[model samples]
Target: MEATPQAPSPLEETQRSGLALGLVVWVFSLLGVLGALYARWAWTPHSVTVEGASIQHLFDVILAIILVAFVLVHLLLGYFIVRYRARGSESALYFPHHTALEVTYTAVPAVVMVALSVAGILLWSRVHAAPPPDAFVVEVRGEQFGWSARYPGPDGKLGRVDNRIQRPFNVDPEDPAGRDDVTSPEIYLVVNRPNRILLRTRDVQHSFWVPAFRLKKDLLPGATTELVLTPTQRGEFDLACAELCGVGHYTMAGKVRVVTQQEFDRWLRQQGRR
Candidate 1:
């Protein structure tokens, strides 16, 4: 006796195609997630400030949780897709929502969100609070394409700045405190010392950023901003306007050199007191 063969049914054909599509999606998603993780780990910059280090640590903690969750979810999804995949002549099961499962999902995410918020606020408070009373002071005014820095003279006090005093550039020449201020093309500070920087803008808006210190603050027209930092490393770090201010935004660049107290004093003297 010989056996007879029959063609696949429409249902079987649909099931076959669905499984193929599921496998392709799973493979591509896994690859994409892995590639992103590797790239992020490869080129992150090193932090030179204690505050930046703390922030980076928090970021790492969050990233680790995210990566683990990502891998687990994708794996579980792939497993279910294959384990309970559609088959010809199979009847679907009816299932209803479970209150316990729903509550678990909602409560877990809410708790995680609250924890992250509290941690961020605590970290911000440590870094953004008032600077030490004896902290070194510096003033920075950003223009369309350049940065002008001022250091308090012997009196150790910055002058009262009135942006309206001058148009393109600002000053109150008669404000005696400002008369002896020293100007520098780039900002400089003493390593391991708290620094209070009073930021101003000459024309439009700009951002004063120090990547190594993880510090960035906007410089608004006719408004003053204060930024505090305590650099723990001695090195020349790059600064740039994080905001787009004008046609020269791409060329807007500055550098901050964190040096020893002796070197900072020497640098101020070289600039010549006004």
Candidate 2:
């Protein structure tokens, strides 16, 4: 004979009411969190570089993955809470393991992680790749309190400055090639032209950073580091040190001036053959 349906006890009805209320509150809370996150995303300062744009795209992909996981987990948690709520008539069901479910969860994450790593490696290689042969070269020196820039003289060659020759002015008086080098208080570049910067530090370690160009590199005392980029837009931007070198680290700053090719040539001439 089939079992007859029985009415729920008054206490059981109260428990169900409470469970429903809790579920509504929890779901609304998740929605509120989602809304807040969206608002934060809408209002944020951003970097303006071709590579930086690509990096942001990568960030979005990772964020999407995280969000999907978040929503799925929350839904499951809510489902379990409602489905197995305290009911006197029902008993628990136990299954040790589900092979397909386990395999799916493991395999999906492994695939996603591998894909992300591969994409990151490709982007890294592209950004760090060699600049073209016709690229113009510039030199930058990071010091305790400020930065010094050097442009190739009329010879279109940067005079070599040895790291061993440390002095008051941060330049070697002995190198003839470097004698013609012009040190500028700021970095000036022609828009849309490839500029490769040679980086060095005078006393300690420092990092050369320009946000708009999405370029940064460490300046070590005894070695030279290189960063290459081409400015697409004409604007003035701040160049900052990303490292904590010492007491005057906050003052270690510079500027990037992206101008027309003609203007850049004229400015170089104005600096003259130093």
The lDDT of each candidate is: 0.83, 0.78
How well does candidate 2 match the true structure, expressed as C-alpha RMSD? Answer: 6.3
Clashing pairs in 2: 159-177, 159-178
Model 2, residue 228: what's the lDDT? 73
Give the Cα RMSD of candidate 1.
3.2
- TM-score of the candidate numbered 1? 0.89
TM-score of 2: 0.79
For 68-133, candidate 1 gives per-residue lDDT tens digits of: 777787777776776667775677886798899899989987998899889999999998998889
Best by TM-score: 1
In model 1, the clashing pairs are none
- With candidate 2 superimposed using the best TM-score fit, by how many Å does residue 265's alpha carbon deviate from the native? 1.4
TM-score of every model? 0.89, 0.79
